[model samples]
Target chain A: EDQVTQSPEALRLQEGESSSLNCSYTVSGLRGLFWYRQDPGKGPEFLFTLYSAGEEKEKERLKATLTKKESFLHITAPKPEDSATYLCAVQAYHSGGGADGLTFGKGTHLIIQP
Target chain B: GAGVSQTPSNKVTEKGKYVELRCDPISGHTALYWYRQSLGQGPEFLIYFQGTGAADDSGLPNDRFFAVRPEGSVSTLKIQRTERGDSAVYLCASSLDSNNEQFFGPGTRLTVL
Candidate 1:
C-alpha cells in the first residue's frame, strides 16, 4: 500500500529557533515530492519540489531535502510569519492511468512564538 | 498575474440540497484539479482535468460528486443530494502542465447542516 506519513503532528518554536519536519512515504514508484505552507482559512502555497533522492531545494528560510524513503523540511531562524501547516505530498510514477494527483500526508502544524 | 480563484469562499447549506462550487484556473494552465480537505487533514484529490477532458475521476468518492471543465479553463464541481459527511473545504488548483507544480486557490469551505 502506498502511503505518506508525517511525524510530530505539531511543533512549537520560539523566534530564531530552528527546527525540521519529517515526511516519510511508501510508494511503488516515486515521481515527485512537494512541500507547501498553508495558513488558516486559506489555500496552500507552493514551496519546493524534489524529484530524486539526495536532491534538495531551498527558499527563504526553508530548505527541503529528499532521500529514498523520506524527506525533511528544515526551517532556519523562523518567525511568527513563518508559522503555518506544512504539507508534504508525493506523486507516484505511472499511477495506473496517465492522470496522477498528489498523495498528501496529514501535515505538521508549526507555531512560532515571539 | 492572478492565481487560481474559487467562488463562494464559504457555503452553508442543508443536507439534500444541491451545490455548485466554481474554480477559475490561471491563464494558460491546461491542467486543473479538485480536492477535498477535512479539518486538520491534507487535501485529497477528487478529480483531474486536462484540456476540457477528465483525465481521471477515480477519486470522486461516489456518483453524487461530479466535475466538469468544458473549456479547460474554468471548472465546476457539483454535489447532488449532499450529506453532512460531504462538508469540507473544496480546493481548486492548476498547473502549467500535468507534471508541474500546482497553484491553489483560497478554497471554498462547505458546511452541510
Candidate 2:
C-alpha cells in the first residue's frame, strides 16, 4: 500500500530559526512529490514539486529536497509569517489508469514564535 | 486571474439531510479534484475528474458521497444521508492536466448537527 508519513507532528521555532520537516513514503511507482503550506482557514498554497531522487527546488526561504525513500523541506531563517502547516503529498504513476489524486501526509504544524 | 473557487464557504446542515458543494476550477484547467479534510488532519482525496469524466472515484469513502462534473470546468460534490462524521472542510483543486501542480480553493466548511 502507498503511504506517506510526516514526522515531528508539531514544531515550535523561534523567529529566524532554521529547521527541517521530514516526509517519508512508500509508493508503488513514484511519480511526483509535492509540498504545500496551508494557513488557518485558507487553502494550501503550492510550494514545490520534485519528480526524481536527488532533485531539489527552492522558493524564497524554503527549499525542498527529494530522495528515494524520503523528502525534506528545509526552512531558512523563518519568520512568524512563515508559520503554517506544511503538507507533503505523493502521486503514484498508475499507467493506463487515468489521473491519480495525491496521497497526503498528516502534515507538520509549525509555529514561529517571535 | 482567479484561482479555484468553492461556493458557500460555510454550510450547516442537519444529519440525514443532503448537501451539495460546488467547485469552479481555474480557467482552461483539464483536471479537477475534491478532497475532505477533518480538523487537524491532512486533506483526503475524494474524487478526480478529467474533463467531464470521472477518472478516479475510489477515494470516496462510501456510496453516499458522489461528485459530478458535467461541463468539465465546474464540479459538484453531493452527500446523501449526511452524518455527524461528515462534518469537515471540503476542498476543491484543479491542475493544468493532472500532471501539474494543483491550485486549491479556500474550501467549504460543512457542519452537521
Candidate 3:
C-alpha cells in the first residue's frame, strides 16, 4: 500500500516568517507527487506536481521540492492569508497502468499570524 | 473555465437513511474522482472514473458506498445505510486525462446523525 506522512502536524508562524513543511512517502512505483493548500471548511486547492527526484515547482511564495522518498513545501515570507492546511498526496502506477487515485497524508495545519 | 462543482454543499441524514451527492466535472474532462475527508485529515480516495465507466474502486470502504458516472459527465455518489462513521466531507475532482492535474470541488459536508 502507498503511504504518506507529514510532519509538524500543526505549525504557527508570524507574518513574513518562512519555513518548510515535510511530506514523506512510500509507494510501489511513484507516478506523481502533489501538494495542495486547504482552508477551513474548504476543499484543497492545487499547488504543484513533482514527477521525479530533484524536480521542483514554484508558485508565488510556495516552492515544492521532490526527492525519491519525500517532498518538501517551502513557504517564503508568508503573509497572514497564507495560513492553511498543506496536503501531500502521491499517485502510484497500478496494475492498470493508468492514473490511479491519490493516497494522502494527514496534512500540516499552518497558521500565519499578522 | 469553471472548475469541478458539487451540489448540496451540506447534507444531514439519519442512520439507516440513503443519500446521494452529485459532482459535475470540468468541461472536456474525461477523468473524475471521489474522495472523503474526515476532520483534521486529508482527502482519502474513494473511486475514480474514466469517461462513463469506473476505472478504479479499490479505495471504496465497502459495498455500501457506490458511485456512477453516466453520460460521461455528471456523476453521483450513493451511500446506503449511512452511519455516523460515514460523516465526512465528500470531495469530487476532475482531470483532463490520466496524467493531468486534478481540480477539486468545494465538497459536500455530510453529517450522519
Candidate 4:
C-alpha cells in the first residue's frame, strides 16, 4: 500500500527560527513529491515539487529536498507569515500516464510566534 | 490570471439532505481534482477529471458521492444522504496537466447537523 507520513505533528517556533519538517513515503512507483502551505480557512498553496532523489527546490525562506524514501522541507529564518500547515503528497505512477490522485500526509502544523 | 475558485464558502445542511459544491478551475487547466479534508487532517482525494471525462473515480468513498466536469472547465461535487461523517471542507484543484503542480481553491466548509 502507498502511504505518506509526516513527523512532528505540531511545531512552535519563535520568529526567525530555522526548522525542518519531514515527509516519508512508501509507494509502488514514486512519480513526484509535492509540498503545500495551507492557511486557516484557505486552500493549500503550491510550494514545491521534487521528482527525483537528490533533487531540491527553494522559494523565499522555504527549501524542499527529496531522497529515495523521504523528503524534507527546510525553513530558513521563518517569519510569522510563514506559519501554516505544511502538506506533503506523493504521486504514484500507474499503468496509464500517471496516478490520478495524490496520497497526502497528515501535514505538519507550524506556528511561528512573533 | 485568477486562481481556482469555489462557491458557497460555507454550507450547513441537515443529515440526510443532499448538497452540491461547485469548483471553477483556472482557465486552460486540463486536470481537475476534488478532495475532502476533516478538521486537523490532510485532504483525502475524491476524484479526478481530465477534460470532460473522469479519469479516475477510485478515491470516491461510495456511490453517494458523484462529480462531473461536463464541459472540461467547471466541476461540481454532489453528495447524497449526507451524514455527520460527511461534514468537512471540500477542496478543488486544477493543473495544466496531471503531473503539474495543482492550484487549489479556497474550499467549501460543509457542516451536517
**Candidate 2 stretches greater than 4 Å from native:** A95-97
Native contacts retained by candidate 1? 0.79
Per residue, candidate 3 scores C-alpha lDDT tens digits across B1-113 of: 78899999999999999999999999999999999999988899999999999999998999999999989999999999999999999999999987888889999999999
What lDDT is reached at residue A87 by model 1? 98
Cα lDDT of model 1 by residue, A1-114, tens digit: 568999789999999999999999998777799999999999999999999999999999999999999999999999999999999999876555453888899999999999
In candidate 3, stretches whose alpha carbon ends up further than 4 angstroms from where it belongs are: none
TM-score of chain A of each: 0.95, 0.96, 0.98, 0.96
Separate DockQ for every predicted complex:
0.82, 0.87, 0.89, 0.84
Which candidate leads the pack in lDDT? 3
Give lDDT tens digits, candidate 4, residues A1-114: 789999899999999989999999998888899999999999999999999999999999999999999999999999999989999999888667766588899999999999
C-alpha RMSD of each candidate structure in angstroms: 1.1, 0.9, 0.7, 0.9
Candidate 2 structure, TM-score to reference = 0.98
Runs with alpha carbons beyond 4 Å of true place in candidate 4: none
Regarding DockQ, does 1 or 4 come out ahead?
4
> Which residue pairs clash in candidate 3?
none
Model 1: lDDT equals: 0.93
TM-score ranking from best to worst? Answer: 3, 2, 4, 1
Looking at model 4, residue A15 earns an lDDT score of 94
Residue pairs whose backbone atoms clash in candidate 2: none
True contacts kept of 4: 0.83
Worst 10 residues of 4 chain B by lDDT: B95-104
Residues B1-113 of candidate 1 have per-residue lDDT tens digits of 99999999999999999999999999999999999999999999999898999988978999999999988799999999999999999999999988899999999999999
